[model samples]
Target: MTQQTLIRAAVVALLVPTFALTACSKSNQDQAQNAQAQLQQANKNLEQAQQNLAEAKQQAAEAKAAQEKQAAQKKVTEAEKDKAEAKQKQSEAKQASEQKTRQARSEARNQAKSESKPVCSDCGTISSITPIQRNAQHGSGVGAVAGGVAGGAIGSQIGHGAGKTIAEIAGALGGAYAGNVAEKHIRKVTVYRINVAMDAGGTRTVTLNSADGISTGTRVRVEGNNLAPLH
Candidate 1:
């Protein structure tokens, strides 16, 4: 070929190769940028997922805590019920025991009176008289009065300001009922211990339901183990 033609052909060849290389480079750069964008998007998704997982864990923990608190409250309520039931059972048992004791005492007293002689009848000079205030007693209507006083005193210290009034009323009601129950079901009796000196010889002790119509130096009648003052 001619030199000019050869030179033109060579120039064309160089230009075509340069253009192909530039196109390939641009395509590779675009692919790389796309890959970077995809990577950024994946990282963002991962961060979001992580946050969601953290929130789920927090919710789970809060739910567990709440369940535990409810369970604890339920246990407390059950415990209180059990305590109340136990107290009721105890009170019942005490009442039964007292009844049994009373029956046995009555039977014993009857047997003793039948067998034992009425020694030193109407014998005895009352040496001393003592008056005792009985509180834990049955059959007197004293329980309600005592209970009201006690409950009021205790309730007055329970709350402050306006709430104290409400507390006092509630306490008084509860205490009154409790006191009545205790008196009827718990306390067997209360009495005075009387001692007597017999002119016939021998000192005797007796129990009286009340101190009325009897005092020191008072004349009394002795029947078996019992004693009564003269009218």
Candidate 2:
């Protein structure tokens, strides 16, 4: 072989190995870049999942708070209703008590008025009647004096001296006593006594000069100190 031909063949052998090594290096770099991109995408997906879980927890907490508030409002409403009912019952009881007291007072007043009225059907009645005789209270001394003078004159004519004087004194004394008694008998009075029975519970007596057609069992009305017949 020629010398130039030998040199060209050796150079060609060396250049072929260098080209294969460079192609292998380039392929490894491309695989490393693809692995890095996949790692970044996995991290982003984990962050999004954590954010969604936090939002779900917040929503649950808000719902629980709303339920508690509704329960508290219901309790307050029930308490207010009970208070109103109690007040209404108390007012009704007070009114009923007042009405009962007024009725009692009215009944008492009516009873008092009825008790104070007078009973016209039972006032008084005539129980009995009786006649009475009464004598004069007294006589004047003029009757005795006149009787003594007439007796003395008659006795003086019967005798003389001392005997006639003794007879005149004795006769005058007897005639004076008889004349006083006779005057009293001549001045007698007659009266009637009436006894009345009162229905209010008592008795009364009345005196009259004559019986003016009054009798027992007759109903009468008692005035101050007098009695009048009932029709």
Candidate 3:
């Protein structure tokens, strides 16, 4: 080959390598761009997945909160119902206690009345004495006789018959006066009065006949025309 031919051939060889290297670099650059794009897409997918997961978690939390709220409401309702029932029971118990107390009072009053007979208040005894003044006359006469007899018997033991007779006369006169006064005083009946307090804050005055052995604070029953005195 000539010198000119050899130089042209050598130039062509160097240009071919340069063209090939340029083509290869261009191909590599395209590949790198594609990989970057794929990486960007993957990152976007990951972000989307994370967002979906957060949304699901939020939904679950809301559902749990709602369920807890419902459970708490149910418990409150049950507690309220229990409180109401307890209140009702307490009311019933109070009513029953009141009723029992009333019944006991009534029974006690009745029992007391049944045991004692009717009596009066003034003399502390019951007397069917007629013509109340006659009681005094009769008692005076009996006392006089008794006094005279006792006096005469004592005088006879200490003096003569005439002195004894005079003493009997004096004794009888004094005895009659005392007996008449006693009989007058004993003829009257006793009277019992009580003030009763009612449940409604009211008070009642109860009057009944008083008798012997009957005392204050005694339970008694007043019947028709007869007052039963209690011991």
On lDDT, the candidate that comes out on top is 1
**lDDT of candidate 2 over 1-231, digit per residue (tens):** 988988988898888898888988888888888888888887888888888888888887888888888888999999988998998998999999999999999999989878887766447789998989887556576667777877777777778789899889867886676667666777777777878897778887877677675789888876655667888
List the candidate 1 regions with Cα displacement exceeding 4 Å. 1-5, 116-231
Per-residue CA lDDT of model 1 for 1-231, tens digit only, reads: 999999999999999999999999999999999999999999999999999999999999999999999999999999999999999999999999999999999999999988987666567788765555455544456777778778877888998988999788878887787778768765665577778888678777876678787888988876766777766
Taken over the whole model, the C-alpha lDDT of each candidate is 0.82, 0.80, 0.66
Q: Better model by lDDT, 1 or 3?
A: 1
What is the RMSD of candidate 3?
Answer: 12.8
Pairs that clash in candidate 1? none
Best candidate according to TM-score: 1
> For residue 177, what is the lDDT in candidate 1?
72
Candidate 2 achieves a global lDDT of 0.80
Ranking by lDDT: 1, 2, 3
The regions of model 3 sitting more than 4 angstroms off are 1-9, 119-231
TM-score of 3: 0.45
Ranking by TM-score: 1, 3, 2
RMSD in angstroms between candidate 1 and the native structure over all alpha carbons: 35.4
